[model samples]
Target: MTNEASLGRVLEELGTTLLDVVCGDAKRSGDVGGVVIYDPLDEPELPANALVLGVGLHDPADLARVVTQLGAYGAAALVVRAPVAPDEELAAAARESGVAVLAFARGASWTHLAGMLRSLTADSGPDDAHTLGRIRSGDLFAVANSIAALLDAPVTIEDRNSRLVAFSSRQEATDPSRVQTILGRQVPEQYTRILEERGVFQAIYRSERPVFVAPLPVSDDAAQPPLPRTAIAVRAGDEILGTIWVIVPEPMSEERSQALYEAAQLVAMHMVWQRADADMERQLRAELVSTALQSGPGSLEAVRRLGLRDEPAVVLALTVVESAAEHALPAQLAAERKRLADAFAMHLTAAHPRAAAALIGDVAYGILPLLQEERAVLVATEFLARVGSRLRPLVGVGQLARDSSALARSRSGAERALRVLRSGSVSRQVALLDDVHVDALLIELADLVPRGDIPSGAVARIVAYDRENQTSLIETLRAWLDHFGDVAEASAAMYVHPNTFRYRLRRAAEVGRVDLKDADARLAAMLQLRLMKITDPGF
Candidate 1:
């Protein structure tokens, strides 16, 4: 029911519940491109017609400056925290810039607001526009708004576990607890606890009719009394799908109650349709991403379908390093992979609407629509940081691909960088192709060498001498080379006296008939050691 063609549609959908127009015209003619958060310290490049959230800019003078700046960049609107009393300067800026100034509602979270805005503007095609009973399938916000219109009261659809799925507008008409629920997208534990104590949930689950709950007592002077709730369990045949909860001042009449009972049926159908459609979309997206990365005949078509046809982008490959101690079961590992892939997709989408991520085999690949390789590196690092150290994820970022056809090359670069990380040659969890180019090359070269080739030249002679005489010459040479000929550090690393290490180094040079001072000879020896898998484990 809502389109992103104008700022008016956003206002109409959200209403005065979560946002209020503080200044300028709400019916501005422009397509809302994307949602961006404003940071005074780091002024990010604003997308055209962007809805910028001025999270902490409250000072009138500062807000006025930002408003003009965003206007110059053609931002559709700027949202600051609520209670914005427009000064003369602020009002004049909004009028001259034609950038609508909106206020975020008190007690609502910026994350929730951003999420709602992004969902409204996400790119979609005809397949995603399919409808069930006039409401777009899988569009829960629209469904919630429709249900609210039917009941003439605010309502929320939640899962069996009491987690909020979708909620209607007019949330401000409810109590503080309801606002908190909307903000967190979940019922507070204290409220859920009270419901459990009173057997409210059990009653709703057990009955076929709507269960009416009386208002809860105020815990303290500051806490508002919770509004009464009328809840009905949504079901499909014998399986209970979820529940629809309406905030009412009192128990509803028979006709209104019947309306809610019937609404549950539609809600069940929509929920079922949403789940099926989501699964299909995920599978389709995975196929498209795979095709695009293959750089074959269908790659261009796949890229077009993915909305990344002419975009310069970067490819990122992510995987979990196996832990021997965990010895994770196959099923558990598969589930973990799916979970991480979904989270990765959500993270990338939130950062950039055009970004696409999907799990291809065991690795999750993400294509970020950005021309700057360094920014992609930063994005990957932030993702890893959010994932934390538990999964021990390694992300390999590739150079910028000029367009759809170049995606395969970027994917190759990413795979090579990932190979370096997986080979344990570097200790970092995230790296770009350029950062690990040498290590990646060495790994590739090792693959070309035959398994039985072993070490050659001076290194081979030293290895033979060490084997026959049980000497420390080979260790001494490796240590000296690894430490860049720093005798004290090399000796310390080998846990031997500096003079002893020096003696062994001289002996190794003599036995191998190699000149230690020759740079070319040292490079040859190092290459041989690398190819022999002596400097690192097998690639």
Candidate 2:
């Protein structure tokens, strides 16, 4: 087995000095060049078995170092061979080393040596996902199927150590369990004494051929399904990621095999893109969530940024709307916020329940930023129209909160408007927070005012005043009642003179046709005053 001349020449061709030539026989050690081997190829498997001693380096000094390391971790022996060399120093040192030294004068030929080294070197490739290209798992799945489709074969892509990941089907794609089982590794076949020894299923891995004969007896489905005669090892750059098993019912044409190879390549690239896209999408969603938490689109600041100062703005709740996941809640809020911002100048904010704006917790917080008074009312009506009788909505408008810091308070105002809407019996009624804020005192009194409680004549007179006088007499009358009808007190409270206040009272009496001094008239006057205090902003 020892042919130092031929072996040395082969090493010469490769021009590598990192060769460790160990020998079982001292006679074989004297003559060798750099990194020669003279030991028998058969040895105990001892890589991970020892703490170190990797690479199987061919240089004597490096080999010596490896031996020293393995010994420290309890290696049983050191094997060395002779390179065709005049390096007497290394050979002498090898003899003196204490470990069970196996020196070989004759071993496997250098022609064999040259070929074996190439195979051993395959796993040491520099391809790492962080340093080089790496396929994401999802991308690998997609590409695996694509490659199989192109090969005219059912291809199953498996990850390292032969775990099935994805595939194209030649047989039924259902029965996922069965499909996965048949994907990467084939079931072992039974053999008999009469049969010749079977070839290993993976033997073709040693060759450059695209397909390998599976070791077991596997038949094609329908007598014409694709073949599993060849498999291509998938690679991320130089590092092998996994293997793609191609099903060819029988041998495939060379052209078809080449096509399959190209398809495998495409699948690899596809997997890479899929990974990138999925990662990006996940990141985008994370950003959206952060945006929602910091402040949804309907925040006062958000509304201001919407840049609509003139449009009427009112906050309204969304009701009876369907939703998907809770994770999407913030996004929905942000979306509605933006929609309102665009349409209503971001005048809305998400409101809490028993507050205003329904589902602001589940769906949206609107900032109807720039809506006009009429437009805000219309928005309420439109919301009701969509919700139908299934739900009711309340709208409230306030002077826009100047900043996001004020949004929480503004939201309370919007809710109060909703309270006004719900507390009163009306469908799609809209109220303004400013009216609510300014009229809070009157609202308390109005709540005590009986419905349809205003005397008919009183109601008529009030209506007449609105039709005639440009000012809202409701607030004025409420103010008077609130001041206890003392002309002096009422006038001073209203920032008017006693005489002017008396004149307004006389006019009010004329409209009602009720005496200002009479007990029944006063009682009626108080009732009308209470109702008027809870004034409608439009008047």
Using lDDT as the measure, the top candidate is 1
Q: Which digits, one per residue and each the tens of the lDDT, describe model 2 over residues 1-539?
A: 12122233222222222233343222222212112222222232232211111223456666655455444533333433444342444444444442233332233233223222321221221333222124323434335445655665555665555544454544343233234244213221222111125533234333334656543443555333322356665555765555666655566788887776666566556556445754564344334322322345543333333322323333443322222223335565455543332222111211100111223332234544332544555545544443323222345544454434444554556656655555452333566666555344446666676776543576567667766876555455656666667678778888887887777766666766766567786676676554554544333
Runs in model 2 lying further than 4 Å from the true structure: 1-149, 161-165, 173-209, 213-229, 296-539
TM-score of 1: 0.79
List TM-scores for all candidates, in order: 0.79, 0.25
| 1-539: candidate 1 lDDT, tens digit per residue | 23434688778667777789999777888678888777675555666888988877899899999999988988889999989999999989999998989998887767668777876665544655777768776667678888899889998998877777778888878998787777776788998899899898889989888889898766678567778989999998888888999998888899999989888888898889877876787899999999998888999888888766567989999887765356666776777777778767766765665688889888899998887888888878877776633456788998899988889999999999998888877889888999999988998888787776768778889999998998879879988998999999999999999999999999999999999899999998878876666344742
RMSD, candidate 2, Å: 28.7
| Candidate 1, poorest ten consecutive residues by summed lDDT | 530-539
* Stretch of 10 with least lDDT, candidate 2: 345-354
lDDT assessment of candidate 2: 0.43
Each model's lDDT comes to 0.82, 0.43
